[model samples]
Target chain A: MAKNLVIPIGPQHPSLKEPACFTITLEGEKVVNAVVGTGYNHRGLEKACEARTFIQDLYIIERVCGICSHIHSTTFCQAVEELAGVEITRRAAYIRTIMAELERLHSHLLWLGIAGHEVGFDTLLMYSWRDRELVLDVLAALGGNRVNYGINTIGGVRRDVTPELIEQIRKVADIVEERNKYYIQLALSETTLAARLGGIGKLSHDDAIKFGAVGPVSRAAEVPDDIRVTDPYAAYDEVPVTAITDNHADVFGRTVVRVLEIMESVKMIRFCLDNLPEGDIVTKVPRKIPEGEVLIRTEAPRGEDAHYVRSNGTDKPDRVRVRAASEANWHGMKHMLEGDYLADVPIIIAAIDPCYSCTDRAIILDNHDTGEQSVTDWRSLREYSINWYKVRGIDTSKIKIAYSPLIF
Target chain B: MSELIAEKQALATILEKFPFLEGKLEIQRRQRIISSALERPLFEEVFGFVTTDGGFDNFHLVIGVDDGDNLGFIYVLSNDDKVMLSLKQSAPKSNPAIKSVCSVFPNALWHERELVDLFGAIVEELPEGPTYPLPDGWPAGNYPLRKEWKVEYFDKVNMTYNPPVTAGKEEE
Candidate 1:
């Protein structure tokens, strides 16, 4: 006998941190269908960027996602610079590459920690965060800030990596490398984790390509689609990146691919440090950008983040459209979540390392005939979820709650 | 020569039936930038050809730009040729309706909804998505991304606006 139940999880929920909701229809324990609704934390950045100058928009785009802030600014700056026809120096490119790789390290480690926490392995969460600090320490040493290191300027990088900074980064990379070995061993060899994540939330190779899955998510599914390798941006042409892929497309495959990619990032950072170019970090550009449209795509920590900038010969942009990596990756999540257990939802959602804030800029007005759909505030959504669980005989009072801002 | 040229030639041949598509198609770097002021009737035919025969299999991103009197929708698609195909179409501001390419690219469901919500461009054949980014009870006609749209604060708490007094006013 099949009992069908529609379970709604988040725009605001304790299990997920981001402002995105998953409404999964379950037939007993198995998920019959799932729908994801994001855009709760929409900041209207693309529209806002049109009002601000190219320089001001750098800071605005950096706030897209705190985790992948560097990549956002890097991609935006690249697009604007390309429009202005200003080529930054080799040193600047290498510095940008180093920053980008360091960001990937921090972001993947953060995801690893969250994945651990979701799977009830608090030890991995604790250890990964402890190691993650090393990457942040390196970032702080270079850019003078832990997160959103305003390092990227319009023409080039704002900060220069001195010999001392390089040494510090190298040391941190060594520590990260050591920790990576242990994590890889644990994540791959541990039978408990294998039982939990293996064969769960599987995205087939065809679906990954068809759905436009990016970064490690696609790579984990054995799709060799990496922006760094395919279209070399920044110092990638000079310092090539090896695209790491795993045959397994499930949650475990995603974990393995990300963990291994961290090691690859470590190697790339070392290469940049070893072959640091000697030149000016920035190039002087005129106040007004030349009238043209340009596209800049960079490999963000999560995936291939692209920005389209249209300049109308003014300091202010005519239009700025950002196609976030998570936007492409979310389709993969929707494809994976169906036919899985309701319990596996949290870890699988985190597997893509989705940044809902980065992805959801446009508003969606859902008018489905299901009659199950309704426009509810976070307060109402939270109350509804609590009542929903109570009806299922779960005690809500015992659970400790954490709150994130619902900034739509 | 390259697959890029072959794809371009194939696209030109397929699009030869519509004269508007002429001079609008060109290869920018590795990408085929197809920009044209498409008529409502021609939208599906052109988009379908590109998706099926043109080998622009992957649907990347769909962005709607407000051009004051009209709204421009850019549907970017790509294939193994590693070239992005940008299919640009415009809808009049008064009507604000364009044919949805969601059928051509199934993954474009969210992208089409974005056009509907932000740019107020009506997408035909696509169902409405959630009123996300904008909360429910937001003014019906208020489209934030529209150039003419100005910011207005709704009194959620029903508080009266009190002007901030100058720091030296009390002392003075």
Candidate 2:
């Protein structure tokens, strides 16, 4: 009971693809506390944007989140275009929607692989990643690049989806759908995977609401908050969105939501391709943006990706703000990690699909005995409230008694 | 059936309810423009309208504009009905500060920070500090988004990493 052990989970951990550390405090195989350390991959993209022209900023924004690249560019473009008072053609909007959906499909598949690996299902990881490559191939075929598809411009999309590529996308969609179904069955059937995920890292509806959680995480907890349906952008208004939700509020539920969402995205892509409207991809964007501001939100694979853009009567925008979904769900990680087995920490953290590139650096860990502190797992801060509160003279029942009576 | 007509009606309704909002709030078919003094209050009203109607569930984007002498912040709010509201608020260049809509939208934190960073416009009552793409050691007074500031040269270097020192097998 007196002894304590500190284990550093990363800067290079198998669970994390990015560089970050999670310091977990162990009390005999059970993690009593966890702390997270970031700042390893801070590129300072926002600061760099100021130095670039409005057109050049598109490429920079696309790199902000590799998986959600299209959303980033679209959000940035929408903001700037609004400032410049440019209206994109209907065909361009459809193309943008299609590209965004493609990104979502690939991103979710990539996440599925990582989620699989997190729970000790390496085969699922391999298969999911292999299938994900096809989506990348499709992206390269359409946008001429896999990662930073400079398809988006201020007025509209820079590239057009040829009829032949649309046919190929349809063919690929069929193949991916068949494979996705198999994986979903495997994920649901495998007892080991189920045991690791089901009822573990539970985020209740109330907790999800309080944290302002979005994307698949909030949907899994039964919150019907999809930006596509709520804020219809691109061709989303014309197309129907059958938003997926699971009330389980667990890792398995999140997986179910994401998998189901992939199916919906495939259907959406097919619809967009079949009804591909004919028109110009882009319009003339004025060099100088009239003085104005605009707030726009688009549905990224993770959740709601919102942007705030301001421009003066100049070529460069006065200000640009990106509120990514990862930043919103970062706080929810604290609630999920507490009172769980030490082994489950990595899987739980992975559930939120955090993007450390968009968040703050430095995670602090304090030792009560020595009054000394060190950088530790960011999740431990959430557990601290419960851990220290239990030791204090404050009684939970008494506190509940005091608050419940007033409510009644 | 026209979006412009619907937006005008919606604007009329908003102005009728909040009588003090007259003249302070300007509506253009899908766009709503407002003075900077009423930006925060107007944001609440617009958000309330969307939530009630269940149409404007999506937040489009927030943009910041700097008029050499003053700063202007514009918010574009749209509903599922296709009606758009473009809201504008102007703050003086000397002390540019306006209330933040993060409390209402939850997504305004990033937008406000970008405004603070690029335009040097302060978002009053914002919980978070400035978070734009500025690098360390950049001069404080210099705001990059202004027309006066020009980029002299672009650095090609990607990122600088500080490797952590390990004390043998004991650390592992």
Candidate 3:
């Protein structure tokens, strides 16, 4: 006789840093169904953008996701600039591209480290993370901050890469190239790591295209849908984008695509630096935006980051809508989870490199039939714990525990 | 196939299809621009330009823009050939609902939801489901993106304010 068991993975799991819960129904070791739950951290960014001025929105937008901060701000600013009929200088466009590609490098390395951790490879994780710090250091030197580089504005970037910073980036990229190659070798080598990931969580090209997967996820499935190549924004048009694709859409395939893409980004960064255009980094932007609407899309580290800005001749935008890439990639979760073992769930989710903070907020469910589906908060968990104790008939008055003072 | 030339040809093709689309469509640079009088047919017209023309291949981004008295939306479409189209659609601010484009591109699901959230524009034939972002008990008539909506601390308080209800027993 076989029995069904339900397993809850996350909302607090070690493998995932994001606050998302997935309940997998298992018939023995095989997962039969998986339901995803989110909404742990809801910042309400889109709604908050309404209150901010167009310039202030850039700072708010950068907080959408720390990993892809620059792209988010860039996309938002580009939309606003387009709406206001402001032309960013060519040098600024190049600088934006360089910054975006650098962000990609850091983001990909971060994902690589997490992917390594997911597969139980701590050594690789440590190595990848250590190398990733170099890229962050380079970003800090260029943008004056590691995470949310307040470089992008409406017309152009706020900060320019000085000659010293350019030299620093080149030197760092060289070191990163050497260290990244070693990490790649380790990730690709060792039969155990390859076996666990190579064929797992396979998404076919047809399914990938049908589901509208973007960035490396789709490219890994052999669909060359790169926004950088398709829609060249910033200096991407100047430096050609060589998209990497793999016929196999497994976890390992996604890993290889990201790894190669990082190399491509490194090359593009070097190319941009060597051929850095000579001009002003910023063009003046008007305070009052004309009444118009514009849609802007740029390649965020994970996938395509898009922003829509509408200006009704006001400092604050009338409406701004952001469509993050993770939202589009979430559709494939069901397909990826089907037929996979419970152990593989973390890896499958990590394969997409989802930024839940940007895609969704805390989830609330209500059941109308019983009037029971009220929003479940942490307090409800406490209430359930009290009920559990009551059901067990624990004599709280009889039991006493001694409290110990802090040793320190 | 330069970004500038491709953008120009795309604008020309769009203008040729709807001659009235000429003056309304404004090109900024290689891949950025704005359009006026956005509607369902106008979106279909732009979609036709993308699918039919070998130049424009992918739909990268869709943004819903809400003006005080009118609602406008923009679609950022791109092609492997280097052209980018920023197509705009608009509806009356009083009744800001438009026909759905889920049939043309299934990816419009989230984009439309974002539009609904920010612009309060209803996409006809939107998948019947629970509203995202907005809380269940969020005031029905309140649209946050409207310029008239002020930023008050009370709104944040109400965001977390869910009326309590009695828990149900397994058996009566």
| Candidate 3 lDDT by residue in tens digits, A1-408 | 888898888879876779777888999888888766554565667768767788888899988887898999989988888787777898899899899989999899988888888888877787777677677767877787777878898899888888988877887787777766766676578688788888778788977865667788888899887778877778887897898888779888898888888888889999999888899988888888888666677788888777777677888876777777887776667677878888898889999998843322123787878777556543365456567887899744354423211110
Candidate 1: Cα lDDT at A158: 88
Q: Compared with the true structure, what per-residue lDDT tens digits does model 2 show for residues B127-154? A: 7442544555555655656544444422
- Tell the DockQ for candidate 1: 0.38
Can you tell me which runs of candidate 1 are displaced by over 4 Å? A1-3, A356-408, B1-20, B32-34, B152-172
True contacts kept of each: 0.54, 0.05, 0.30
lDDT of 1 at B102: 65
lDDT of 1 by residue, B77-169 (tens): 777766677777778888988877666566777777777677777777895657545655555555667776533332435422222345224
The better candidate by DockQ, 1 or 2, is: 1
Model 2, span A260-307: residue lDDT tens: 888998999999988889999999987777877666778899998877
Which rank order by DockQ, best down to worst? 1, 3, 2
Q: Candidate 1 lDDT (Cα, whole model)?
A: 0.81
TM-score of 1: 0.85
Native A-B contacts reproduced, model 1: 0.54
Candidate numbers, best TM-score first, in rank order: 1, 3, 2
Which tens-of-lDDT digit does each residue in A239-348 have in candidate 1?
96899999899899999999999999999999999999899999987779998776777889889898888889999998999988898888767789988889999999
**Predicted structure with the largest DockQ when compared to the true one:** 1
How high is the lDDT of residue A362 in model 2?
Answer: 35
- Give the poorly placed runs of model 3, Cα more than 4 Å off: A1-12, A37-40, A356-408, B1-62, B67-105, B114-130, B136-141, B160-172
Error of 1 at A114 (Å): 0.8
Interface RMSD of candidate 1? 1.7
